[model samples]
Target chain A: MLSKKQARAFFLGGTLVTFLIFIGLTIYSFSKGNDQSNHENITESVVRGKKIWESNNCMGCHTLLGEGAYYAPELTKVIDRLNMKYNGQGEEVIKSILMSPVPWQPNGRKMVAYEMTEQEAEDVVEFFRWIGEIDLNGFDRIVSPLAKEDNNN
Target chain B: MKYKSQKVAYWFFALSMLLLVLQLVYGFVMGFARIGFDNLHEFVPFNTARAVHTNLLVVWLLSGFMGAAYYIIPEEAQRELVNVKLAYVQLISLAVVGVVAVVGFHFNYWEGRKFLEIPRPLDFLVVINVLLFLGLILVTLFKGKRRTTTALVLSMGLLFAALLYLPGMLPFDSQVMDSFFRWWVVHLWVEGVWELIMGGILSFLLIKLTGVDREVIEKWLYVIVGLTFLSGVLGTGHHYYYIGVNKIWLIVGGIFSALEPLAFLAMALFAVNMYRKGEKKHPNKLALYWTLGAAIVSFVGAGLLGFAHTLPQTNLYTHGTLVTAMHAHLAFWGAYGMIVLAIISYSLPNMTGRKLYLTPRGRAAFWLSNIGMIGMTVAFGVAGVAQVYLERKFGMDFMLVQKEISIHFVVLIICASVFTTGIIMYIIEFYKHGRPTDEAMEVSIQ
Candidate 1:
């Protein structure tokens, strides 16, 4: 039993809301455009590693900074962890791990070979290094690899 | 013995309700565990329970929709369903596949995606079920007395659902390609095909209940189906933006998904207009709630939030967060779940030949469930924004952040518990008030 005036108001209100949403989205999209174009300062090695990552579909197995497949480890913080674990031999240790066939098993985790050339492995290590350097201060927290393993058990 | 389509629909409805109850229990158990993680061992872990919860929701909704279609199509077409045996067979196959898929999750035989977790074997069974369903629907429509607008759109939806699911099941070398096809099945079905079916069913029911003009309802259905497909097919781009797909997905998914709200808005307007112009009064108030609420919720939850994250840029921030979960919970429940409830409310009395009114307790239950849902939506939405702020703005340890966010889990659990109590009350009232004679009247009318 809505009056004509009320119906008109309703329609007008709906139109206003829709227009506001469109405006908000336009502004947001424009802002993100700036962010994407700001990546011109990225290193060549990182760019090469990104290509390799995409070509091999590494995201199908590994996650980078909480994004991608959860089948493998988080590579974003791998550089710092490798540095800490291998006593400052961050890049070399990562390269060796990728090149050398190491069988590491922790229940429910299947061993998969890292099939990459030495130079490709180095490039991936450099990618991780670059990601580690990106200021993640205002980024979503990556899923904890250890916690996921703990859950599986 | 002649097979009655009403009998089949009732049986399927009952079975769907049973599954729904079980799903709710699992949801509650999972919610509780989220609060007290130490209580449940890995034997029935959160991930497994979550897989069961989501998959069950999909299966039960499909079952209910299929049952409704089978019941309504024949009556609207003014003929018997072409193959009653095939309908029964489709039901059995779906039930078997659903059970195996759900059981497989508890046994750790899942593929590990949130909603698409059923293992390969169970997936094959589902594909078979879909094919059989499409075949039955198409054959029935072809052999029926006349083609109504509802029958045509519903049949088209069934056909598209089967076709879309096929590509997703195929093995593809590229994960990006696989992901694209997966969204084609999941997004297209819920947002696209299902909307068509729901619109058809809703229009049919409204025509019967309110004595609205068939022409008006049918026109609304046509517009809804058109909008659903036009916006929804391109809306698949929303998911593609972040998954390493081409950058074009950002523009396509964002702009089109933004337009998706217009469909829901139109649906709302249709309902409101019908109510305004109707010659006959709606017999049940609750049914009116279901009809109008579905339109509002789908508009706000699915349409608005859909726009919110449609932008590849915003999605970069919102993907995988609780914000996504909020959108999903509201949209699916509002659009599909409420529509099904509305359909059942309208048809049940006709099927049973009983004037069913919600008891005071039932009314209370309805309010409780509605309020609980609203609380959960707001709580989860706020929690998601908070998580985004804390995680992105502050370099908090990811695990620590999750633990901190456990507070929201507690709130959601409380809300779900209230909702569960409401559902239980509803079940009790349904048993007390539901009349089989009302259905006898409906059959006589046919």
Candidate 2:
């Protein structure tokens, strides 16, 4: 029994309300949540490292923050792995790999040894270090060693 | 064509077909690359191929929608396009921009944003191109004698789609901030505004093909529009989960995105009901097949499969897995892709003065593409589940998990080949239609 005008109004108004809720929630999260607070004191090196990351299109192969291609290992915990397994030689290991450019058959990694400067390699690894420090509360770390430590019941 | 200006649509559709071929070529490149055929890795790496593949999809679909508008707006509005020559200019400029952006990907000169890899400068050009397109469509719709519901819905969708792109262009320093806003462009487009476009185009096709009353069909349009907004607007939160956003999105996104299927379901029901109610049989059974298929398959793909991994707990393991790929391939193929094909199927004969409706080749194209895509979706699903178990749950090496799933890509390539064959046949038939003449619009198909 509703008029077409009524239906259209309900449709448009509902969309408006929903969109506003999204904006409101996202703004609240940014001001009072984990994402913005950690990034408030971003160092230049971390920022430079981010630029290095994008410029090299490392995301084309690697997943960061649980986003990007799944071809390579998730970089969310790369720094943790390096510290625990490589005795904090993560930067040198990553740099060597970038310079050598071959698929490590053991890991089945198909990453190209991207042509990057030594400085750029440092910046990229620095970026990873910055991300590692952020407490994601186990984002993409589901059932991993990190989660196991947190949930040891 | 009803108006001489309508002939311009043929060129846009032609451009769409050409770009579609290029899109498939890149798809094959990535498909082969995935199976360890790294021959083209040096020239067109997997990342570059993916960028090109996705961008080509967006460009070709835009071209198709533009073509549909050029053909539809004038007929719906009962007026010729305000400026035909400028439309040609817009098309040519669109081709130039698309070519430049695609080529830049090879040189690693892209923005590196998935589905938004075009650099900022080219984005500006895209904006201008869309502005020109909207100008033509909106002007034609408003100034004409009639203002149909279908026209308004289609134009609104186009206008909103343009406005949404601005958010993606805004710079964000924080990765969380950037990812948060990025979904506003990505999820909102496919799930929100694009559904509006689908609804509008669906209404038009149903009215024409079913020979049903426009009022009855437009009524369904309102319902579809309502459901799309109700579910899709909040569904943006689905991407917010696990992206360093508030934990609230876990509940908000899961609850909301879970409801997103309702919108697609309504669409399927709407199409089927309208189809059953209509007594008049339109000779263009091919168009009807596409029109109906788009509605039903969209529900299954976007609604059902998207639901499988949309919940927060499930998405935790499947966030960037091949599960997303499975949902993506079918959803995109079913919704926007098939809707564009529907309009092309309907308008081609009208524009070309050729009775190519219900041809055996057309039937084969529709079935093969659908069957092949469904098979590909299954292969991706099997691989995704295995990867989730081996890598995410069992904590195996990422490379080891990928090797375990590599066998699935062999099935994927085979299915994709069948899909490509269908598309090639469709294009060949499109080519056989020759050109549009002014007389075609007056000569209705029997």
Candidate 3:
């Protein structure tokens, strides 16, 4: 038997309260001590790399920090992952792929190769490194190569 | 079709249909790419195709919502649109911006943020286009004799949606910060304001289709949207949990997101109950099917499937995998897509003065599209769950896991073909209805 006035009040009041709380939570999450986003660690190179990443729409294919199209590999732990698989030549491998003129087709899935300069490749690698370092509240464990099953097969 | 200005909605809907077809083409491109038949790799790369597909979905849905507003506002407010010519200008500008953004994706001229990929300059154009749309809608509603709750809620939803878009335009050097605000635009619009739009439209449709009392329908509309913002505003945390944000989001998002399904549940129950209570049976059976289908299917798709992966623990495994895709495909289709189609189905016959109700083709379109989309959702779910286990849990190579799950994509393609056939029939029906005539305005069905 809720009246129309009560329903309208409920709608308006509930929306206002929840929205206010949401804003408070957002501000608190990004405040000085509560900040876990590694804002201080974001260098010029990381910004440049992000620009390149955005310009190329790398996220259309590859995931970074567990957000993207799911078409390509997640690059959150790419540095650590590559270093493990390529005998510490992970940086070189990434650089080579980025600098390669042709598409990088590993496992028959083609990546649009940028044929970047060494400097550009280095910037991207730095971006990955920065991304890998941030504490993801245990999400990094899943992305880490060490978390894989023991069976090579 | 009580007013001549309502006919303008027809053009906006036509544009929506055109964009939807283009969106499906890009969808097929991505589906084929997943299965390694990426022949269009050089021309329409996966990223390009993805950007086009998602952006197109946004545009078509926006177009449909705009069309619905144009049609519904005049009727609910008891007046013609304040300026029909300005409305047309808004429609054309919207189409032009959408086309340019889609075309720009092909040439690497994009801002490249997953959902918000249109470059900054084009974002301004979108803002201007939306401003014009809101101005016309608001002006018409305020100038009209009545300002019903349904109309107010719909306009409010549109207004908030435009405001939310500003957050996505803000730049941040930190990728984490960029993502945090991006959800302000993406998550808030979908879970928050868009539900208002949906509720408004649902109430309007139920009022007309069910012959239910407007006051009763509008009262329940308030309750439904109340439940939406209650859970949904705080539910934005679900996206914040793993995106380099604080652990506070894990708890906040988990609890609030768990409550989010109640709103959708309320919507389904309300729609069904209204139907049962209705003494009058409107002739537009196809619209009723879609309206009821939207409510029920959104509950299963957006509410339940979303719940399946929304928990912080489960999301840790399924965050970027095909699991999200599973939930998204059905969610958008059931919630936004079906509603748009419902309004179109209801408005078309009235506008064109063609009472082609209960046609076999229309019924076929309904069943085929729903069944096919559900099949596609299942295919994505299977692939996504397998992906979570193999790639994330077992730590297999991404490409290796993709190869294992490629069969699901094949199944997806087959099901998508069925869905496309239904859509083709629906379009054929749309075509047969022909243009909205001012003559039809005299015979107001409602």
The number of the candidate with the highest TM-score is: 3
Between candidates 1 and 3, the one scoring higher on TM-score is 3
Model 2 error, position A18 (Å): 1.0
Q: Please give the DockQ score of every candidate, comma-separated.
A: 0.06, 0.56, 0.84
- CAPRI quality band, candidate 3: high
Tens-digit per-residue lDDT, A3-108, candidate 1: 4344435433544454365335434433544232223345777667765654444443455644443223546657665565568787887676566665332232
- Model 2, runs deviating above 4 Å: A33-37, A101-109, A150-153
Specify the poorest-scoring 10-residue window by lDDT in model 2 chain B. B437-446
Best by lDDT: 3
CAPRI class assigned to model 2: medium
By summed lDDT, the worst window of 10 consecutive residues in model 3 chain B runs over B437-446
Question: Considering lDDT, which of the candidate structures 2 and 3 is the better prediction for this target?
Answer: 3
User: Against the hidden reference, what TM-scores do the models get?
Assistant: 0.77, 0.97, 0.98
For candidate 3, what's the RMSD? Answer: 1.9
State what share of the real interface contacts each candidate retains: 0.00, 0.49, 0.86
Q: Residues B1-446, candidate 2: write the lDDT tens digits.
A: 26768789999999999999999999888778777886877788888888888899999988988898898889889889999999999999999999999999999888777788788899999999999999999999989989999988889999999999999998766666777787888888899988988898899899888878998788778878988988898888888777666777888889999999999999999999999999889999999999999999999999999999999888988987889899999999899889899999998898888989988899999998898899999999999999989988887867778888989999999999989888888898898887888788677553
